[model samples]
Each structure stands twice: as C-alpha cells, then as structure tokens.
Target chain A: MYKLSISDKAFNVLNYGFLSFVLALTFYPLIYVLSASISDPAAVSSGNMWLWPVDITFEGYRKVFENNAIWTGYRNTIFYTVLGTLLHLCILLPCAWALSRKELMAKKAILWVILFTMLFNGGLIPTYLVIKSLGMLNTVWAIVVPNVVGAWAILVARAFFQQNVPDQLVEAAKIDGASDFHIFFKMVIPLSAPIIAVMALFHAVGLWNQYFNALIYLTDQDMYPLQIILREILILQEVGGDSAAGAVGQTENLLEQAKTAELIKYAVIIVSALPLLIVYPFLQRFFVKGVLIGSVKE
Target chain B: MELSRVQVPSTVRRETRFHKIKKRFLKSWQLYVFLLPALLYFIIYHYVPMYGVQIAFKDYFVTQGVWGSPWVGFDHFLRFFDSYYFWRLLINTLLINLYQLALFPLPIILALSINELRLGVFKKWSQTITYAPHFISVVVVVGMIVAFLDPQNGLINNIIVAVGGEPIDFLTSPVWFKHIFVWSGVWQQLGWGAIIYLAALAGVNPELHEAAKVDGATRLQRIWHVNIPAILPTIIVLLILNMGNFMAIGFEKVLLMQNSLNLSSSSVIQTFVYKSGLLEGQYSFAAAIGLFDSMINIILLVTMNQLAKKTSDNSLW
Candidate 1:
C-alpha cells in the first residue's frame, strides 16, 4: 500500500469534501421543493419553509389532486407514454436486430442514411410543416410518430443486439430447420429483454418529460400532458384548473389566491415528478446500463 | 490479343453487379423486411422534413402549398442574414455556448472525485443523489428553480438576506441569466454526464495504476497520468460533439426560464425560430434562419470531426 503523505491526505480530504458538497448540492433543491410543497401557504409565501416543512399543510397536494385538468393531463401522458414506447420498440427493435445481423446486406448503407439525419436535421420549422402537411396536428400520433426514429436509440439497440445475442444461436436455430422469422421471434426477442427494458424506460421517461411536443402540436386543453399542465401552474399561473377548486370556497381574496398559486407550484413540481422519483431507484442500475449502452459503442 | 479477349464487356460487368445485388437481396430479404418499418419511418418523418427544407427558399404560403409556392431563391435567408437581430441572437448563443463549454469539464472532474472516495457508502449515496435530478421533468426542474429563486420567499434570497446581502432578482436580470442557465444545467446534468466518463474510467487498466503506486506517485498524480489518459478518447469525442452542437441549446428549459426582463440574454436562434415560425406564422423566414443554423452546425460538426481525427484519431465519423 502507498503511504499517505500530508499532501496526499489533503487531496483525499478535498476529494471527499467536494463530493459531500455535490451530494448536498444535488439533493438540497429537491428537498426544498418537497418541504415547500407541504408547508403552509402563508409560510411558503413568506419564505419560511426550509430543510423541513414549516407549519405542515397539504393545501398544495389537495389543490393538485382536485384539478380535473391535472387528471386529464395524467391520463393523456400515460396514454402517450405506453403507446409511444410500444410503437418506438415495435419500429426500433426489429430494425436494430436486422442491422446487428452480420449477414444483413448493406447494413452500413442503411445506417449511413440514419446517421445522416443525426448530423443534419432540416431544423424545427420544416419538421413542423411536414407534420402540418400530414394533418397530424392535435393528434396523439403527432407526438408519438414524429419522435419514433432516434438515431442514438437505433445505434444503441443495434450494438446491444450485436453484443448480447450471439450469431451462433441463430446459426444453431437455422441448423434445426427454423426459419428466419421463427428464429427472430423465438430466439432473438426473448434474449432482447434487457435492451427492450432499457428502450422502454428511456422512451417512457422521455414521454413523461414531454411537453414541447404538446406545446407545438396540440392546442386542445384535453390533449395536454401532465408536464404541459404543470407548466401552466408553474409558469403561467393559470389556476382555473382543478387544483384550485378547493382553494375556491374558502376565500376569493387576491392575497389568498396568490398564496395558493405559489403553494400549488411546489406541489405541482413534486406531484409531476413523483412517479419517476418513485420508480427510478429500483431502475437506477438499468438506467446506468442503458445510458452506457447508448453512449459507449464498445 | 489474349488480354483483350479476357476483358469483360461493360454491359456484362453491370449485369453481374446487378445480379450480385439481387442475389444478396434475396438471401437477406427477411432482414430487409424487418428494417422496412424503420426505413419507412425515417423516410416519412425525417426525409420528408428535409424535402420541406426547400420551402425556406420558396415564398411559402399555406394556401399555395409547398409545390405551388413561388421560388424566392435566397430572399428569406438574405432577410434573416441582413437583420440586426441576427448578430444579437448569434452572439447570445455563442456566449452561452462558450460559457457552457468552459464548464463542460466539471462532470469529468466530478467523476474523478467520486472515483477517489474510499468510503463506499458515501460514494454510492453521492452518485444516487446526483443522478436523481436528471430524471425530473424540465417543468419540475424549472419550477424548482422558480421556487428556490423567488425574490420574496425563495430559499436563495432568504439565505442571501440572512447573510446580509441584497436579494437580487436572479431570473429577471440579464446579468444573472447565463449564470443561472448554465449553473442550473450543470447541476441537472452533472451526475448523468459523469456516467459516460465513469464508464470510461472503469475501463482504465488496473496495472497502470498499480505501476504508478509502485513508483510512489501520489493519488492525484495517478489520476492525472492513468485515469485521464484512459478516458481521453471519450472526453475528446464528447467535446467534439458538444462543439458541434454549440447552437442547439435545449429550447424547452430556456423557453420556460425566459421572461421579457431576461429576453436580451435568453433569446437564441431556436427561441427566435419558435417565435417567428410557430407563434407569429412567418414560416418561410423562420425556416430560412433555421436552415442557416443547421448549415452552420453541419459545418462545425464536420470541421470538428476532421480536426479531432487529425489530432487524436478519435472522431465520430
């Protein structure tokens, strides 16, 4: 073992110290939001909330839950995520698998076309115009289909297939008189569980975080996703939605409404992210693996 | 001559190539069939937009349609290029990018720091907390920012006031805009970005570190000599990609954070394009600006890739 000199000990102390700060820095904002969410509206508005809740209250939670728009947003987001992830996987996996096959003719040529898009996009307006021309605006397919072919995902999934699913297995299946389709369905798809999970999680999380698509394509309030609705409460201060339905009967005062609106943003922040945070720890390992697969080609 | 007699005809050559292609296609028809859906998707969703890019040159009118629209040549592009807004938007974007690029090495440093921690529990906990914020929605993240920075009641302002400093309106001020934008971004992405470098670090040869230790090198020296070199390829590639994407800032978070007070600093090419093309309905003009932006990006990416290839033999291409 190497002897620790004074400078070495100093370096060790600084390293741990900086990392501790990083832990606190990353963690504190989230804690602040959580504390603000439960704190009394008066306390929140007065900046009394800190490391923990001040005058603990669920006024924010109550407001977030009662809102019909939020429920609609939640439902629409779920609909988008599930269907979109499925559609993404359906289009992505088979293509990736095919590309992974060394025998697949002109793989490089096909990948070149895909990679070309990543290098040079037609920019936002032209894409929107294309969507408009397709009459996909204000529709679910507008958000889902337009975002289906991510070049990174395709490459990652291709690399994953190539790495994980051995070519020998396909050859063995072929020797057993299994057709290409049978081998793909029976052998390849089953082995694809990890990549599938990774893709699904990524696509689902993307859909969950999605609002820009809704902002552009869908104008209907009914079609808005949770993030969009959350944006409204957070930035726009549009409180005609359900979250304020409870705050209604008690007070019509401007001061009271302002406090409610302030409280609601914190609540909305927590409520909006609660699902991902709840699910993420269990899926953390998978996420790290997925990210590595996406980023590191080898 | 015998040599001339052995030479194949051009038609024979072409026909053999065609037959070879046909045979290959027939053999791998199933793979092609599997790829058809993705290809169709790329054609419809990706290529079609590229085709729509020509409307940037055309005097695009919704009623006339893309085909029927008059060919205005570079009028829209010229209009954008000539406008005073062009310089402002470009400068603002470049400055922000430069600022961000300056901070890009933080994640690499962070990963190195995390790797140095002998305490396993703290290391795992540190990583978990740092990584947790990435999964949060932009709305929630921005919302958290708004809450934490709220002038009257925000935690930041409260802390500032407690320490006897004036509670500056961090969001609205143009001076604070880049700092808030970049630092918040760093906070959000620090851990997630570290993952790639950490993954790279994991591949560092243990023998090299052992040799360094045997040579009585310090911990920091080992990291500098062994760990950094091992991850240099990954870092260079990421740097090249980041430089290539200099103009392509995340429009969502910026749009959310933007206010009229901070508009001078916050306005970038994408936001400007969104305003004109989507909101104000100057589709052709917006498309022209967008087209110019993408052209710059492609040039940058190609140039950077070529440079990296020449210098380090590590390029995206």
Candidate 2:
C-alpha cells in the first residue's frame, strides 16, 4: 500500500542503520557482563570471554548462595519493598483522591505545600536527623518511612484521579445518598486500577534497588539491603586477587571470589529486577496509556 | 445567582454554631479523613525535617539534639563559600548537570527516528535491545564500563590494539572522566527516556499527516509541520523539569565510578555531602552545603517555571 521514493528509501535505510548501531551500543555491555559472569575465571582473566562464555559454570552462583549475608540481604530487601509499597499506596491514593476534588477546602494551600517540597527539600542530613530523631535508625522503618510517598508519584496519581474520576459520577453517587468515601472506594478505585498498578511497579522497583538509605541509616551489616551487600561483595571480589583485597576478605580462592562476585552481581540484578520485569510486559500496554492519561492533562 | 447570594448571607448569619460545625464536618469529613495519612506523612517526614533545616545555621551536635544545638548563624555557610573546593564542586556539578541537560533530548530524537522506521521486526528488535540496558542497576552499569575500559585487558583496549591504535585509560584520565560519565549515562538512559517521547509521538494525529501528504508535503516537511509541533509541549515541559534539577547528579553512579585519579573531576556536591555528613558526621557543614545546593535548585526551578509560563504557557505551576 505504501511506496517510497529513492530519497525516502535512503532515509529509511540510514535511520535503520543508526537505530541498530545505537541498539548494539546499548546492549553490548550487558552481553559482556552476562558472558563474563558465566565464563571460567581463568578465561575471563585472560580476556578470552566476549559475547559468550568461555567455560560455563554454576560454581559462581553456588558461591553467592553459600554466603549467609546474601540471603539476609535478600530477605531484608524483600521485606522493605513489600512494606514500602503498601505504605506508599496507603498514603498516595487517598491524598490523590482528596486533591482531585475541587471543592475541598484549603485545597490550594495543601497543593502549594506539597509542591513546595517537590522543588525544595532539606537534603540528606536533615532528613537523616529527622529519621534518627523518630528512632528509626538501624531499623527497617528507617528505609521505609521517609520515602514512602514521592511527590512525583503523588502528582501522577492526582492527575490520574482528576482525569479518570468524573465529577458527574461523584455527583450522581451523592444524589443517590452514597457517602463520598463510599463513592471513592466503590467507584473511583475500581476505575483507577491501571494507574495504581503503574505506581506500585514504579515504587516497588525503586525500593528494591534502593541502597543509599540503607547505607546511611543502618550501621549494622546484618541490616544491609541486597544492593549494599552486593556492592561490598563486588568491591571485595574485584580486588580479591591482589594484596589489597586481603584487607576486605580472607577468602582462599581470589579467582573464585571474583567469579562469584561477578555472577552474584548479575544474580542480584536478576532477582531484584526480575519481578518488576516480569510484571512490566503485562503492564507495558497499560503504561503508555496510563502515563498519557495521567500526564497529558497536566 | 441573586437568590443564592441573598441566601448565602442569611444562611451564614442564621446558622447556629453546632449546626455550622456539623455542616462543615459533613461537607469535608471524607476529604479530611482521606487526606489524613498523607498529611501525617508530610508533617512527620517532610515538615518535621524542614524544621531541622535550622541546623544549617548552627553547630549541630547530635548529643544536644536539634533545638539545643548552639547557633552559629551563617558560619557554616561562610565556610562553604570560603572553602577552596567550593568553586570546583559548584562548577563541576553545574557543568556535569548542564551537559546532561544539553544531551538529554538525544533519546527523544532517537525515539522519533526509530518510530519513523518502516521495518517492522527491525524496529521491534531495536526497541527491545535499547530498553534492556535501562533496567540494569547503576552499579552494574558502572562495572560494565570499568571492565570495558580497563587498560590491561578491557574490550575497548583490545579493539584499539586490533585496529593499530594505542590503548587509552578512559576511566582514570581526568580528561576522559566527564565524557565517559555523560556518554555512559546517555547510553543507559536514552531508550528509557525515549519512552515518554514515543508515547507523545503515538498521540500524534495520523489524519494531519494524511492531509499534509495530500497537500504534496514530503515526509520531512510533514514531520516538521505536524509531528514536531505536536510533541513540542511535552518536549518543553520535560525540558523545564530537567532544567529544574540542573545540579542534582546521581551520587551512586558517580561514587561507583570515582577512583583516586578521577576524584578531582568526579567529586560533585552529592559525593562531598555523603562523605562529610554520612561518613565523617560533620552534619552541620554538610547540611549547609546541601541547603545551598537545594537553594540553587529551587531558584532554577522557579526561574525555569516562570520562563516556561511566560514563553509557552506550559509550566509545572
């Protein structure tokens, strides 16, 4: 049905070539990492591993699993993500609902206050002090509480509520003697599922990958989340063959440690990321649609 | 309108206190109850910490707590302003962030170009490949960069040797630090960032393109007249938001990538604060620097928002 001129064909060819080049550039490192993680340590050291594994081994993964700290980190990370997401939704949904309604008294002032923090925060130290003062230091709550509801998520949810929940529906519900709370719970939330799912995914992935808060707040190594633990493992493994690595570890096999660290990095990434990635494809269709609905009006 | 106006004054005057309170409660109880959790969180997490910002003007001692911390007004601020590293940190932070802002739109361009492709399977494959790297953790991304740029056995060096060129120490060299950081960041983020642009592009009206085609406008002309103009608002909005955070570089990635040799170029305000506050526990000094950093961000956000409003009537406000 479509016909292209010579110049148009050339343009298309050029664009395709550029796209492919960019794709390769983006993907090459990931492939390199994956290949290196699986390759034999000796082969990896000799620079033989490239796009594929030199000697495939599950030993690296075995070593990662054998470490007691890794499992603790995983458990803590999971706990944080689940609790954080729940707290996030609990705070964000109702706030968005209230903000979406135009007739709410002091709405303008509330909005200004919320948006003010979005542009300006007291930064890390003060926030840390507040968390410390609240007696959340070294506790799971330290990681979960302060960042439970991001301003961006609130804005997105607010936009979703405003756009999707029609005033006429609420008015009709009111006329029918239904309370405002009932209308929101029964009608608005049912319609707001797609956006909620998107927000949940966003927040969950963020919490899963989060390490900075854990690093700053939790002094105990046992309380470390997966990312921080993985960082420790990675740094230790990278330098383990050298005399300097001895400071961080007394592991017998330096090569093995390096191999395990590389694999563990991949494993940590896969484990932490796989849940969201698995959930993402199913939500991908909804994502573009939801973001459009939420953002376009704003 | 006249009847309502007359009734409003009478109703206000005639209503008993009990009835007024009841009515007020009835009207707003749902909103207030619904907003409770978020309000509590804002008060506890955001607002309470906001009060702690006073520590920036004091010598905050953890033992004495925020209130009891002795006031040394403007001393920490003066220290930050007068420090030898202040200009370097400010300039480096600004330069890196500006570089990011300047180069941020390449992904959008890439998305636009990719969306325009006629090849179906190729397009799908390219998009999938491009988006895959975005999901990788920043730590892993930096690790990959280090491995590829390793002077001894890195893939890049191997390639250079194969091509008869000298191997370069990309990560350690201060000259190459910013370029590597920015380009690697771009590489990782381009596809993910392009997603919003692609979404905007999808919203473009096909009928406009058809109409332009009927008018004998070429694809380039049609894109110029139709597509670019359609996504201009989104582009402007994103640009304004990007400008708002023109100093907040990701501390984790920079921290991961930093080595002793590259410390001069890599140590931004975030890393500086992380070291001074979290690692060294100079809470007051770090708070002052952070407060100054946030002040710049606020000023930039306000200025950009105002400019966006003035020029295009599209702003965060």
Candidate 3:
C-alpha cells in the first residue's frame, strides 16, 4: 500500500470520527427504547433512565403479552403477511416472467396496462369504494388481494429474468417438448431463486408493516393488524392524553395507567419492530441486491 | 397442385395472416395464461377504481352508484379551490416536499464519507447500525418521535431540563412540525437512501482512483474529482424519482403525528381527502381534491423528467 501523508492520516481520523458520530446518532434511540422498556416505569418517567436500564423489570413485557389485542394483532399480522406475501409472489412472479418474454404476444399492451397504475390511480376514495362494492371490506381478501402486484416489482423481476435467464434454455426446453408450465415451474422457478427470494422478502416485509390499508378497510377489532393496534396504544394515547384513561377503563387509577402506558409504549415498539430488526443483518445482502436490481433501468 | 401455387395474392396473404396469429398463440398461449391473474387484479383493483374516479364530477351516493349519480361537473373542485384552506394545504404540501428535496444531497454526502473509510469492523458496524432504522415501521418511528418529544420526562426534554432549559412542545407547534417531520424522515432514510449511492460507488472503476493517487492528489481531492463525478448519473436518476413523488409526503406518518393542534401544517391533501371522503362521507368533494393532487403530481413528474432530459442525459422515462 502507498504510504499516507500526515494530512491523509488526519483525513482518515476525521472520517472515522464522523462515521462513529453517525453510528451513535442512529443507534442511540433504538438502544434507549430497548433500555427504557425494561427499566422500572417510575425510573423511566422520572428521567432517571437514559442510556441503560435502571432497576430493570419485566412488567412492560408482561403487560404487552397479556393484552389480548396485542396477541390478536400479532396473529392477524402473521396470517396477513404469510397469505399476502404468498399471493403477492404467486401473482407477481408468473406475470413478470411472462412479460419478460420477447415472444409473448401483446406484451407491450399488457406491460403498459400495468405501468399506467404507477403514474395515475383512482386515488383513495374510489379504491375504498371498489373494495366496499366488492363486499371485501373488513375481510382477509381486502388485505391480501388489492395490493398483491406492484409495477415496480414486476419491472424488477422482469429485468432479472431478462438478464439472468438465458433465452436458449427456454428454446432448448421447447425443443425437448417440455411445456411452458413445465419450464416455468421446473426450470425458471429454480433458476430464479435469488430474484424470488428478494421479491418475497420485500413483499413479506411490506405486508408485515402494513398500516394504512388495515386502518382504512377494517373496523373490526378482531381483524385489526398489529399496526392498527399499535396505533391505538402508542398514538391514540397521545391524542387523548391522560383523560383517555377513564374512557378505556383498562385501569382505574389515572397515575398507574399513565405509568403503564409509558412502559408499554417502548415495549410495544420493540415487539413490533424487533423481529424485522433482528432478522435484517442476516438478510442485508438480499435487501441490497433488491435495491440494486430495482435501480437498474427497465 | 400447380393451380394452387398460382392462387390470388390477396387470398394467400389473408390465409397467412390468420395462420400466423394462430401459430403464435399456439407457441405462447401459456405465457398469456400466466399473465391473466395479474391482469385481472389490475383491472379490478386499479382500472376499476380509475373508472370510479368519475365520482369527482358527480354527486355520488351509495344508493345511486357511480353510473347513476347525477353529473355535476367540477363543482366539488370549485369548492375546494374556493375554500379557506386551499392555499394553506397547497403550501404545506409543497413546503414539506421542498424541505425533503433540499435534503436529497445528504445521503450522497454520507455515502461519500462511508466510501472513504478503510474496510474494517468499524465501517461494517456503522453501516449495519445506520441501516437498521430503515427497517423500523413508520408507526413505531412516529411513536418513538412522540415519546422522545413528549414535553414531560421525554428524553429530549430531559436533556433540555438537565441543561437548565424549558421543555418545548415539538409536535404541537406549527413552527416545529415541518422540521420534526423532515428531520425524522432524514434520520430514518439517510443510510437506506445511501445504499444505492454506495452501490454506484462500488461500480466505479478503481483505476481512476489509483491514477488520482499517483498524480499526488489528497484523499478529499480524489473523492471530489473521482467519486462525485462517478456517481453523478445515479444522483440524477434518484432526483428524478424524488420529483415523481413530490406530492406524496408519507401520509401515514403525517396522519400519525398530526393532532388538531398541528392541523394547520399537517392537513395535507391526502389527509384532507381521508377526512372528507371517508370520515365525513363527502365522497365527491374528497375525490375532486384527490384528483387535483394526482394531476399536479403527474405534471410535476413530467416537467422534472423533461428538465432532466434537456439538462442531463438522465430522465425517468
């Protein structure tokens, strides 16, 4: 390696120092949330808890797990995520693969039809009206069906197929009298695992974090996703402030309710976000690959 | 057989055209079949609602349906334009978007800084930590924001009080609304946004950097000359993409952060539409506003794309 001058050495030190600051800025809140969740509620509210837990307790976690709403939301979210992602992939992959084919007839028209949705849409009310008209309001289909395919995902998958799946493979399979379905299922699907995995991960995470759709469509508490429930506990509390305690009647004493609310907010945030955060480092490469694939011009 | 070979040219052409279509269909019918479900989905969910957009011009009622509703062309739009809040909504929307657009260079700066670092555990760990927030849900992010900015006993307030200062209500005040919204968004997205730039930087030809080093350039000089120029195209493309969604300002997060206290700044077109159309059941009025918002969005996107095409060789199209 070339020898660094004193200025270059100083630059290195400054760069490292700047990056360390950025790391702390990003990690501090997350760490604070984690720390606050376990710290005694009184300690947290008294401003005694800052960087680390003080007088740690499991009270917050206990409250979160004991709440039926949290469990319901968790179960509902899992169901929606699994079902929605499966449906998303099932519809997306096949359509994207077909669009990628040069031999496919009316391909331009089909691709244009999909692409138009990206530019202009009916907006919110009309979409909600359509969902209501279909009698899908407050149903699983409302969550899983309406948003299965994105034009961006299709473009990404189509680009992947065009780049990675050699045309000669399809031609060879055709020559062997293998059907298109056979080629798609047996050959293309296996060969396109990277794209599929990336797409699935993206779709799954989207479904997991879904909030707006659930908020708009479902009114039934039983059907509410984790985000909606989280909104109720985390956001609604702030909206109503301390006065909402008497309205909900979950606890009698206003002060105790306030303390518990503060405690559970941090825990709930961790509960809702921790799974994805913990899994992120492992799947970071696929996430990077997905973004790179997306940035490639269609 | 000889007579058949001497068939009329028109007849022969017609038969061949028919046969060609049939042959093509036979070869790739499965591909069309594979595309059907997605086509159906777009038709029902997207295209159908596009058709339903006519409610913007009609007095839409649940009983009458979209077709049967009486035509009242542009009345709702007229009301929205003439309303007290029109300019405020428009300005709020534009201001928040402009604020975000102004910060677009930050991620590029970050990526450049990261690229300057030597490969090691520190660099890797910093990268990992920075990208972690992008994975957090908007609900939780906003929750954290509200919690941190809570006037009493919140972390930020705690720090202020420790320094012998008064706790400021960050969320409720209109003055702090845009700052909190934009800065928090920057915080969440900075590293994630830099990923694309980093990817672009990784593709930069290493020989250019080597040659710069041989020419006695300092590290900062090389970064300025070599790296920034290398990632210019990626930056342009991302800028155009940003312009495409200029009107869409994270409606969910805004809605979460919003209260009656900050409605003056937070009542963007989308939230307004949600309130009028869904909550208050003024479907026609809200649809008109929604339509107006989208029209402006498309116009801005096209204009920016054109501008980019003319100035740089980069355009979203």
> Per-candidate TM-score, first chain only?
0.92, 0.87, 0.93
- How big is the positional error of residue B194 in model 2, measured in Å on the Cα after superposition? 1.3
- Over the stretch B165-224, how does candidate 3's per-residue lDDT look in tens digits? 999998899889999999999889999999999989998999998999899999999999
Compare candidates 2 and 3 on DockQ and give the better one. 3
**Candidates by lDDT, descending order:** 3, 1, 2
lDDT of 2 by residue, B1-317 (tens): 00101111223454596587567768869888988898777767777777788899999987888888899999999998899999888888988898888897698788788779766887776766676566656755675676668686678887787788998999888889889899988987787777778888888988998898778777677767898899888888888878887778677788878878888898899889889998899999999999998888889988998999999978987
- Candidate whose DockQ is highest: 3
lDDT comparing candidate 1 with the true structure: 0.84
Interface RMSD of 2: 5.0
Candidate 2 residues A162-240, lDDT tens each?
Answer: 8778899899998899987898889988999888888887777778877778878898877888778766665334422
Per-residue lDDT over B85-119 for candidate 1, one digit per residue giving the tens place of the 0 to 100 score:
88889988889889999998999999999888775
Pick by lDDT: which candidate is best? Answer: 3
User: Residue B120 deviation, candidate 2, in Å?
Assistant: 4.1
Q: Candidate 3, which segments miss by more than 4 Å at Cα?
A: A238-257, B1-15
State each model's CA lDDT, in order: 0.84, 0.77, 0.88
Candidate 3 RMSD to the correct structure:
5.8
